[model samples]
Target chain A: MQIQQLSVFVENKPGRLAEITEVLAAANIDIRAISVADTSDFGILRVIVDKPKEAIETLKEHGMTVSLTNVIAVGVSDHPGEFSRAVRLLADTGFDMEYMYAFISRDKGRAYVIIRTNNGQKAAETLQENGFDILSPETIYNM
Target chain B: MERYYQPEVECASREQILAWQNERLVKQVRHVWDNVPYYRKKMEEKGLTPQDIQGVNDLKKLPFLTKDDLREAYPYGLLARPLADCVRIQSTSGTTGRRVVAFYTQHDIDLWEDCCARAIVAAGGTREDVCHVCYGYGLFTGGPGLNGGSHKVGCLTLPMSSGNTERQIQFLIDLEATILCCTPSYAAYLAESIHERGLRDKIKLKAGIFGAEAWTEEMRQNIQEKLGIKAYDIYGLTETSGPGVSFECSAQTGMHINEDHFIAEIIDPETGEVLPDGEKGELVFTSITKEAFPLLRYRTRDICVLNREPCPCGRTHVKMSKPMGRSDDMLVIKGVNVFPSQIETVLLNLGMDPNYQMIVERKNNLDTLEVQVEVNETLFSDTVRNLEKIEKTIAGALQSVLGIGAKVTLMEPKSIQRSEGKAKRVIDKRNLF
Candidate 1:
């Protein structure tokens, strides 16, 4: 129950995001969810695309430093206090989350949150054990 | 290995050396006063004449010559000899304003080569030894000085002027070059390259004479272990003829100045007050024998102490410690001189803010220059690809200006530390012992 995410090292400059998206669009690789972690000098653009391998290869060919990271995608109820419970469960189980971003699924009345943890497998197992729906690569990529 | 190059001179008595200096200095002062009108004005403004300078002790009475004086004098103002009489010119790598050119007569060239020959001999060089000179030729003094010295010593001289590491190593192995002459940094680079190629045992180098820039004892040890050779430090400047002003003997304590031709002095850089021996201060050199571009009481701006202690190598010449620091902000990167003002000028001309930091480090035995510049909001908001392009543009501009490549890192505005009094511009992390 892990999804492959593309992490790109990007210098903090104008039109860089557009260029990356342009490359992905040109390659017909659909980005499902995207978030950027920024520092003063540079940024790490984390992207979940439909074809992770293709996206990585295309970006690498353009001389970009891209890495494939395994992250757990958790399906949570799109309601108040529901996301907090899942976060609390992970916290109680000593699963330290590096970063996380959420996007609601259009078909179902549920929200899917992508989380990068220190240990992805252990976090996925812990979430599943606590009766939360853990997303598989196929499900996340398809969504 | 034999120590002194000219025994009567290198191991000359203090009284004898002083007498030679007194006579030569008096003659040189008079020569400059009669020939160089620019220096004559400086002496005239101070209400002094050549007659006022009787000996080395009266050197302080003479007007001090600095880099500014050299710049103001420019091409011909400081030439103490007729243009037709001078044979050559060696210049400082002018990364800043104007290049300071020092003319050399045929006799001057002979003396300069003789000084370099003394350096080689002091480093155990002989006629049987093949001297490989990799210092850049042309206007730069390092290569020509050593090449001529190698010929003077009867060494089969290899005039491989800088760069082309593979070819240099191939020649080193094929020719069995025993004495290597180049900048200390280049020596380190060659040593690293040789080790990386696994050609340690195939080489036959026994000693290296490194100069043209500042190096530490730690760097010396590091290069020595890698190259399996004793690295000797040499000291010189274009103003005082090239490498051979002073040289380190087998004792390796400090470089002994060629007192027969040049007189070394220590002075408080602020007040110009002469300091006694063993006191660390600004080094001053008075060329008693230079003819074409003779300078009196030329301020070197190098901070070091002079020792009059008898050397184990039997050279009675006064020894000067390796330059501890510079009184100015001049930096030597990869043996090329760089000033922070030069970098600032490049940045401002490009419409960028002058807030920047230069980081110098020795990686893989080669000096790496990284320029971290603060990016404006517009640049920071640009695409990563565009930002990278800008970085490359800035790097290219710096390279064109500096004559050396620098890695340009675009940083956020206000990220660099700002100071109220003096801005901390350079961070040199090369641990020098």
Candidate 2:
């Protein structure tokens, strides 16, 4: 299962992140998870949103440089060793992770991690085979 | 005291100048018809002959020659005189296409020198003064042209050419050179050097004859103030003989065209219709007295106005205003016309927003063009390598339209500024005029 992620090009300047958030807020798009890959010049803002397709349109309308990426989400038991287990599963299979970020789920004793690996479909299959929950795009977006 | 090299001809009456032009235009047309077959064929295409063009009024019927015509002819197509009879050749510092090589006979040199002499005298040069000629020599016409003019005016001339700034200042002081000749930029450079050495008191430059590049009135005043001399502007092209075609006299309103040697006309660049005096248009020159290479109705591409307004300098030659700008906004980058509107068309055709910035830089003495377009979804990809591929596609598309490769950079949206009106599309760091 593949999840939709929005990657925005953000210039390194004051209040740029705030401007992006304001645009999503005005369009009633809630950001579910966010990570910033930053350099001295600019940053790549990867975000998971409640409504990704709508968030993309609204952010683009506000003249933001944004693109889509297909990533896989895997759920693990909300414990210290559970976070390590999911990444070690992909690592042992030699599936390189391009980028990965995690967030706690509201459901009791569970957590979700978004991973952009070299192969999204294959990585999802590998995680599911390893007794981890491969979350679908609908489940991730509705989270 | 005001002095003129040839007072009688320089201050001739309107009728006298008109008669001279009519006779010369008639003779020059016949000369081109009988000798320059390239131009003869053009005249034949128009169903015209030497007998058809009687005076300057009939001059419009002849087809205009452009830089393309000169390049098409290449090294020898436009020569009117045989190589044996031609004594020398001078060329433009052409950054585009084939360099224009103009052949000159001994007599042609004399007349050209005489034109330069008029400019020197207009700048208050005299036999008692030592004139410094710093314009580059060899192929380029500036140094040689002014050097010959200074000699003709009987000024003890120093053919310094350009560069070697310390030596230039040395000669300026030791020789007490009264007249300076070079490009305005080089003049400013010399002034800066002179100031750094703190030898302004030792220098004795009275007037400067600066040309071969466009300059501002403010630059003129600045150089004049720095060097403690009255600076004058001169204009000419190798195609019409160098830096004495027109010169700003002491009157300083505009430059007086040497109408006796060349016929100048301002015409609509697009329609080729000649505009009346005082209307801004493309300047076209017809070399009437040139014996070795007589070009008729040659387009100069410099947009300026001609006025017959009486000059207090008493030189009756019609004056031309300083060049305003080019007739078109096309930029010659690496010898190709890069029009911004054409880039817009290319981007529009590719189904993308044309909001972009064009950067011109000079590297290794060569011009480079770079286009940075704002990234849109259509051109963006998650992978950095894929984004580079998208940039290559834009560069390839621009090359297809511009005939020259441009470095393309993908910028974030809204990275380029867009004012309320007339967005600046180019950032030129070349320092070219």
Candidate 3:
């Protein structure tokens, strides 16, 4: 139930994000959800794309430093407590979440949270056992 | 205005100078041959004796001493005089490898200070001026050399070593220090600092004698314009008794070597054949008057040419052009010879700070060069694509100059280490052994 995410190293300059998006558009790869972690000098642009392997190859061909990381996507009911329950479950199990970002799927009436934790497989198992819908690569990419 | 410090020696006729050189060179060779066995063995290995060297023309017959020999000898192997006769020891900055300690007797010190005194006098220093020396003291030769030279000139000497920029400026404005002496980079920094503080008019510096590091003419112009003074270039190395081995006259041409005391030569670095005057080659020096550390035909490794044409300043000593680059510091990447100064020239011409580092590594048996350049505020604020374009521009410039491609990595401001002494500009990680 682990999903592949693309992490692109981007210097903090204008047109960087636009350049990445233009490259993805040219490659016909869709970025489903994107988040940026930024410092003064550079930023890490993390994206859950429809095609992980292809996206990585294209970005690497563009002379960008790119890496693939394993993350878990969870589908939760569109409610405040529903999001907190998944966070609370991981906290209760003593598993630390390194970072997480979420986007609401209005048509599906659910909020999908992408989480990176210390242990991906164990966190997925715990979330599944706690009555949370753990996303598969196929399901997330198809979404 | 008095141009030559020791008019009798500096303005001596060519024949007179040659006579003095031949006499001193013969004495110095015999002195080293008898006292410094380390070099005497080098002479013996070549199957030669002091009797074989009769005059300056026979200098090429002697074996050349390099930094490696200095390291091998360490402290006392090259000392030509007894310890009791030696008065002090001055060392190289030793940024590259082992430190080279040079012993100086009182007479040696006196002559060295006289060389520096000549430099100061050439730069318009006089007995009434206050000479401020900011080169590092204690082990480094710049501060001590210029300090003693300032004293010799009868100037009120301020032995202010490097750093403490604020205090340096304070004294500059307060005491009206007329002549400033330090490394070229530090002089540039002081000019920058003074300009930033709007204290240009307050600074009473009439001349600046800058050396101990390589600086471009553009930087010289920048420093001169900022400080409103004539910046004179001084040349020396610790192996040959510090700054004042040569110095620029008011003519602003090449620096005139103190040929009365040190005999200078240019040689093909690879073949060790002495190159003709005006041909760029590695510089070599033979100390004729130094009593303590009398090095004969010592290889200096600096690449430059000697000019014998009549200079406007009228000093008869042969002048050496500012060293273009060092033979040792030139980087060979992928069969292309690259000097850090070339890259620095490109960056400075592009209106960027010259702070940069060249990292070389071997990957899959191919040498790769990566130039990490610090981005100033102006460049840092540019769009990412624009920054990338700038990197590409720099890479193209470097390729055209070096005949090899290099990866340009833009680093954040203040990321590169700032050096107070000699700047370390290259990091080669290739295991060539």
Candidate 4:
């Protein structure tokens, strides 16, 4: 399963992050998880919100740079070896992972690995076929 | 290697370029004298004939044609050929009365598109690339000019003429558009849109050709950083031709005119004396190959400099910097000449947003200029006092920098209409023409 993530193009400045959050708060869109990938000139503010469509429209109406993307969100055991085993499997399957990060789930003993890979659909299919539980937008947004 | 659609012949050594121009100039003069009634009568009024005009150097002997001349001539009166020979017409839209139109025969259109093709090639476009034409279609020269040129280069074209930013993003991502052509302001808007849609990394656009409105180096840098693409400046007017009259190459210093089809001149607007290279003055152009309406020495009123040095791209045709101001658009306030570009420079230098709309009106016989600038939400916290402070600070800055009193209004971000085509930055309602 692939989760829909919102990536906002934010000019790197002091209060840009706060401004974006303010818009989301006013729209009542709950942010489940967030991370910012940044360079000196700009940043991609990635967000998983309860209402992706509402959050995007609200941010856009407020003049914030935003984009939507499909990313693989895989459930993993909280134990240390979980991430390595998943990576090893994907590597064995010839899937190249661009970048990935982890977010702790509200549910105990489970963590989610948010990954950007070259082939998201095929990776999701293979992960599902191999008994790895793939999280959908509904699960990611709620978490 | 940098591209050149045709070997530049205009900058060929003094003897050869002029000799070639003289031959064509003689033919153009005879054509005008025989076909166009306006030029024929104007020449006759000065007690001159085609025989009196011998060469390109004698261009000054001919009267200068301005936009007003086009308006006076109206639709097809100035056309040198019959309607059957004219293949297309392109017009410029101004807030002032009656838009100025230019005619192009099949040959003229081909030459114009060739000039556009050369501009694209200079900016690193190729047949394998996909071109996204975002310039507004119909009544604007930018869309079709680039469209025809991209087709000539065998590039897949996306004629996505202005507005509907969502669809623009979709096509840019889906088609992997490589080359983008549009006004600079629209490019900035598109950059904002792509980033918001999370499609910045998905876009394959390598270069953007921006023109039609005046933009600053700061704006160019802003767009380039946002979109991760090279930004090139282009210059043209409907009076001469559309967007490919001149363009920026990899050097990015200035726009190189396609002198093989258009003759470029720089003249002092007031004294009318032809200025030397590097002297900032009004730009004038003569259409050498336009058959339907071959305008001779048409004054463009754009203030800029012409560079003759060979660019790294290897085109010898002279290059012109982005126009500093227009002679007719310059405002005389308290006897000090002020152009909108100067205000833009000050606004950008202060680290303020450039989404400003200027209002010039006369109050009690004194000219008053009010600048309404939209505050960037990311920079300004939502507070009335903060907005007031910004307004006061901008007013003080403008007062000191321009040496004139101005009222500054800080507006909500995105409240100012984002321009989809050419940015209309000035609104002189007082001059109600």
Candidate 5:
């Protein structure tokens, strides 16, 4: 199964992230990994948490605008050529990455890149068929 | 703003307004009988003429010119003057079919601007203030009308039009604009933008006179809090005169019609029976002093109540409650009449943000309604079960208020698409045509 991500829309103001974090803390939803994609008007607080559905619900209950997205987390050899080769695989497969970011694995020798493509199911099938390592919810949770 | 048009014949008392309206009503009746053949014929059919009308009290005797009349006349049949004599024309595009257009002479434009100037004054605008007109320009009548009024008031004006958020902010900072003129929806957008940009400290805007669309009190408070300004409501239509027919005075309870220039009447929309003041009904306006396109008792179809109580602002003009949903804005879904304002009232009563979207669709010949509400961060929790419960609660609220079941979809804050002009609240996909 694809990993569910939470994209929380927050006004670009100070302590907004802290406020969101406090709500999650109280809810006991552990944030696995989070990154912020910001624009001038507002910022998208993209979060990968242990419990995506629960996190989304809690955030919604707190009056936050959040959406759940299915993304493929690709495990790659922590090398420059490997990353380039994986991107080429996506390009050759006709799948465009809407957004992506790298997260370090616990071993530190291997790296994981979380990718959100326009078509998640097709991209997942294509990447799987191409022998590329597309992550599962269990793999991401363990990492 | 108030200084812009201290009526050339300012009547400070209610008695004066009645006297002025009575005189104008007599003259307008006679003028309609003489010039406008359509009004003359209609009045003659009703066994009424200039001789049958006495004064303002006799206004009820005149038959109202409904929008159907405007449509029947089409382009120029309503004009009381020659085409060459008319200086301006304003129109509102209807979602149903052809746009409604009204013409005006130079004197008419001046009088309209004077009414706008009265609005500016009522909102505490001054000659030294800077007015930023954000209402749409061109055929929309709001921008240019407010622009003319600001100039007449001697306020340094920024005719910014609408939707250049960055440039509008820049002007507000550089020019220290004190008054804002725009639709309430756009004002909310600007306020949201200013808050996001953290420019609230730099923006000098103190008062906003918003119109051209219907808005709720919750929206008013939200805009007020975000912009640090007192938000005022103005009511008008291109069919009458733009932006200045009635405006919220300092009291902020209701809008005071420039009763001296226009006669206001409440009439039962169904039976065409004129209702007494203080009763809720369709508002009708008769342009008393207008020369070119003086509408004799035009039915505006704006539903609101009238109050003749004296305002603290020392004006005796009859005040109108901010017009509720337009007669045309009413949505007939599954044979049930619904107004978006009713949903707004429910949302506000629930302590939820008024930002909502109504999706209407037809499936298997049955109407389906979905209301997507943005989750307020203050009320959300990080749990799946709780979010579903909140969604159900919202659905329950919707069902109770609307008397029709709606599938409630919880949306992320700022995710429903903020509108800068008219808030797109409905998506009617019934294909009923």
Candidate 6:
């Protein structure tokens, strides 16, 4: 299963992140999980939110560069080897990953890692066949 | 004490100067009509012969020449003299466009050197002075122009072209060069280098004759203060003899246009109507004296004003103020003429969206260009590396097309401002005006 992640273009400036967060707060959009890939000049803000469609609209209205990217969310047991095993499976299968960020669930011994790979469909299938729970968009949005 | 290279002409009265212009204009008109078929055809279509253009007053009756005309008659189409008589050629820095090349005979070079000599003498040059010329040699005219002028003035000329700052400073200090000639930006860079090496006091530069690029009055003041010299502005283009047509005197009001050799006019850019003296408009020049590549009523596309106000320097020549703006969409980046259309061609050829903005800035006395393109769905990617790769690809393409590197910035969609259904193409932060 693939979930829609909001990717934002962020120029390196003071209070830019704060401005984006303030916009999300005003629109009552709760950011479920977020990861920032940064360089000295600029940064890319990848976010999973409660309402993907509304978040994209609000950010676009605020003049923010926002795009929807398809990323697979894999649920794994909250253990050190569990996270490594899923990535090792993808690596062994020669599936390249752009980036990945994790968020722990409320339930004990459980976590979801967002994986952005070259082929989302094939990677999700590979992870699903390898004894991993492929989390759906609705399940992640309600988390 | 005040000095002039040629007192007879530089200090000539209005009547004598008018007499010279009247005679030269008539002769030059006939010379062009007889030799340059390209311009002669235009004159024939207008149903005019050389006799109709009797003096400077009838100058406007002739058709105007622009860069397009120069390009059309490139290499030898507009040569009034035979190739055997031609001695050299100088060119403008135009990349991806037809390079404007001007031919010169021995006589033309002599007169051009005289113009430059007048500039040097006006800047307090003397035979005892060591003229350190760093204005770039080769086809570009700045170095050779000043080198010839310094020699005519009898100053010990150093033909050191631009760059190699360490050696430039060494020569400046050891030889104690009195006159420094280069672009205003290079002059500023030299000042910084001298200070950074803690050798400011060792520099004996008394005056700097800077040209070939646009600069602000504040930049002049800064360079003057740092180098401990008076910075004078010299104006010229390759189409018209190069870097010596006009020069600033100690009077510091404006540059006196060597009015005896060239006639300067201000015309409304849109209507082509001649504007009165002291009015700002596009500058036009008609070379009455250039033998090989004489341009008649050539439109310079530079926005400036001509002033006949009496100067304290005692030169009777009319002075032209510094060019304030351009009549068209051309940007002078690091002394290179960059047209927005040229940039557009590169982007379109590379399958990029036509919407882009050119940002010109002056950082550390150097010109920097940044091209900002709006991101479309096809251009953007979720991965930063891929997006950055696109930027690098565009930058490389621009470098090869423009012969200069530019920073490529990918802006968001619908971000570039549009006016009247057209995007504002250029945002110049140089503040040259």
lDDT by residue (B1-433, candidate 3, tens digit) is 5466798988889999999999999999999988999998999999999999999989999999998899889888999899999999998654223568999999999999999999999999889999999988888888999999999999999999987999999999999999999877678778888999999999999999988766668777888999999999999989999999999998888999999999999999999999999999999999999999988888988899999998778789999998876778765464334668778887887888887989987653346898988765455431245556778889988777665688888765444556785556988786432
Candidate 5 local Cα displacement, residue B116, angstroms:
0.5
Candidate 5: residue B131 lDDT (0-100): 99
Q: Which stretches of candidate 6 lie over 4 Å from their true place?
A: A11-30, A49-66, B419-422
* Rank order (by DockQ, best first): 2, 6, 3, 5, 1, 4
Residue by residue across B224-251, what tens digits does model 2's lDDT show? 9889999999989899888899998898
**Between candidates 4 and 6, the DockQ winner:** 6
What tens-digit string does per-residue lDDT give for candidate 1 at B1-433? Answer: 4655578888778899989999999999999999999999999999999889998878988889998888888888899889999989998886647578999999999999999998999999888999999999988899999999999999999999999999999999999999899988889889988998899999999999999888888889988999999999999998999889999999999999998889999999999999999999999998989899998888998999999999888888999999988888888888778888888998888888887899999887688999988765434432345566778888999998888999988765455666895558898887642
Q: Select the stronger candidate by TM-score from 3 and 5.
A: 3
Worst 10 residues of 5 chain B by lDDT: B1-10
TM of each candidate vs. truth: 0.77, 0.68, 0.76, 0.59, 0.59, 0.91
Off by over 4 Å in 5: A1-143, B1-4, B7-11, B328-433
Write one digit per residue (lDDT tens) for candidate 4, span A1-143.
67888877665568878988888999899988788776543455788889999998898787765667788998887998888888888999999886677889888999988887778999988887877779988777776
Candidate 3 lDDT, A1-143, residue by residue in tens: 89999877666788888998899999999989999876555766889999999998998777566778899999998876999999999999989887889998756679999999889999999999989999899988988
**Superposed Cα deviation of residue A1, candidate 4 (Å):** 78
Query: If the candidates were sorted by their TM-score against the true structure, best first, what order would they fall in?
Result: 6, 1, 3, 2, 5, 4
- What lDDT would each prediction earn against the true structure? 0.87, 0.86, 0.86, 0.79, 0.79, 0.91
User: Per-residue lDDT for B1-433 in model 4, tens only?
Assistant: 6666665553366566667677887888889889999878888887888887788778777778887778789887789999999889988654223457889889988988887888888778889999999988887788999999998888999999987888988899899999999877678878977887788889999999987766668778988998999999888888777889998888999998877667788999998889888999999888777788899888988889999877777667788988887778765453234667767877887896687878876543235788877656454532233445667788887887676788886544454455685557777654421
Clashing pairs in 6: none
Off by over 4 Å in 2: A1-21, A32-54, A57-65, A69-143, B5-16, B67-77, B82-110, B126-144, B147-179, B185-204, B268-281, B330-433
TM-score of 1: 0.77
| Predicted complex 2: CAPRI docking category | acceptable
lDDT of 1 at B417: 65
